[model samples]
Target: MADDTGHTTPTRRELTGRIGVGLVMGLCGVLFVSTARISGGESIRDESGSVAEVLRERGRTISDLTDAAASKRTRIEELTQGTSSSEDRSQLVADAVGLSAVSGPGVRITLSDAPTSALGSIPGVTPDDLVVHQQDMEAFINALWAGGAEAMMLQDQRVINGSAFRCAGNTLLLEGRVYSPPFVITAIGDPDAMIASLDSAPSVKVYREWVEYVGLGERSEPLDEVTLPAFEGSLTVDVARTG
Candidate 1:
């Protein structure tokens, strides 16, 4: 395009079209870079990607497993319907499967980590000092059982013969489920004896000292009635080797 009488100049329409194409190219370049970063995992995740997402996925998996286990148990019950001494067999199977829910006078004990500020205020106390460990939970459960708890529950699930308690950071993982503080353990037994047992274990003693020094939380209450839900996860022996 030519300006009147002399120098050639681009028309306004030509200039605008070139600028628009340039902008589009610039945007495309940016999107390309962004996509490369995402493909490289730099933009999408950190070293430990989405712990919350992993936990939610685990929760969904556990739910599905529980439902499948329940269906299998129902099938087993149907198959065993007319077996010898059916009533006795059923009772034995139910108890063995941790399907029986029990209620009676019990003692409820809760253990919780100290607040961060509380731990910070204490001299020489680390963050670990403020959180309840798996050992602490095991101590209470063992003591309660030794004190004659007919049935016990930890965080609403029945404590079966093979139930395991583990600690993942500050959270409690019990029998394929995760729980956050405060962890509660209820035992249907002589409340006095249960509480006494909890108070007397060596680990429990250490926990109490931390409770005094670091402000960890501990509470025990006797209840006239407390019922624990039946264990819902698979009871199938995952590993079996003939002796």
Candidate 2:
């Protein structure tokens, strides 16, 4: 196609095609630049790295929380030490946190595992049913707490906010030490109230039923006077103060 200067001019179809291709290329370049700028020069991450990134973030969060807890504990201890009358504060700590000996009227509840031959003798008894479980002990302790117990002892150790026991077969692991059956829990409180709480707990009811069926040992007796020793283990906690 010729113009005034006698040059071969491009047809309308060719001109239109050229403009369309130029526009498409320009739009593509704009999008690529915009994405790069938004991403701050980082490559787009795939799903493979997503989980690792999340885990790292969680670890950092947990570390921060642990640091905060330790800081608060230190602050609390500092404040506690700053108070006047050190002897009175010490007595309060001893009395409230089970750090001192307690003597009062309470009840003694003992739990023991069933006999080896009794497992097969019972109709629906399994190996687990023939032994005292940690939960059973937990139920008894919780019942005593609910019954207005002032002081408690699990075995020879004072039961505090930090006491924990786990069942390993027919024995119990309590705060790094292990002991066999016939676990004793003595609580200084009203014996009648404690007995009523024990009888009313659903878990205790179930345990009693198992005792009847599988011959698991359980005994409860009121004591006219009982004395509980102070906790002997190392304690770095401030349970009573915080509470």
Candidate 3:
């Protein structure tokens, strides 16, 4: 046997150690893969939740805007329906106009005068002093609403909820139409009440003075059968896109 010079192979203890190391390495690899998967899944979930929340908020906002628009449309419809009788229509018109007049049971105020003062001592009125400015017109319209006018029309243009009264230079721009001096603003309301409300407004008083002194275009004409036009404009809300 000695002559065979047999050499012992690796012991069982040594073999066990090699096997253990391999097992530990395998476990570590599995743990790393599991962690990575969990992290990635969580990121995806967060992104999805964020997108859903944003969509919900947008839906809510759109719904609110739609409701408001619908309400306004309904109000307009109620106001525009024709009255049963001409007398009723007249009364309705009277009530509305009452809330919008600048003076008495509805007064027609006219402003006209000589351009220049005569010899003793005076100067000619400038163009600015003669015409009503945008602000003046706006003030008058706003006062009408405060007074109780159900509806209003400037010249032939019907003033609606979305109506914008604007002035460019000395000319008035309303609902895309332009009018020169002596602009007519007609409203349907109580004649006396409308005039009272108008007189109550400080701005109207100031304008009245201007009409008397410098001859700015004056307020006038409380016609019993004055009719205003229906509002003509788009009523849609524009939404912005999200990237």
TM-score of each: 0.75, 0.62, 0.48
Query: Per-residue CA lDDT of candidate 1, range 54-111, in tens?
Result: 7666877887888898788779878877767976877887776568766789999999
**Residue 216 alpha-carbon offset, candidate 2, angstroms:** 0.5
Query: How high is the lDDT of residue 214 in model 2?
Result: 81
| Candidate that scores best on TM-score | 1
Tell me the tens digit of each residue's lDDT in model 2 across 83-143.
6698578868989988678999999999998887976676776898889999999999999
Please give the CA lDDT of all the candidate structures.
0.83, 0.83, 0.61
Question: C-alpha displacement of 116 in model 3, angstroms?
Answer: 7.2
> Which ranges in model 2 have alpha carbons more than 4 Å from their true place?
1-84, 237-243
Model 3 vs truth, CA RMSD = 18.9
Q: Cα-based RMSD of the predictions, in order?
A: 5.5, 12.8, 18.9
RMSD of 2: 12.8
Q: Which stretches of candidate 3 lie over 4 Å from their true place?
A: 1-126, 237-243
- Misplaced by over 4 Å in model 1 are 1-48, 75-84, 240-243
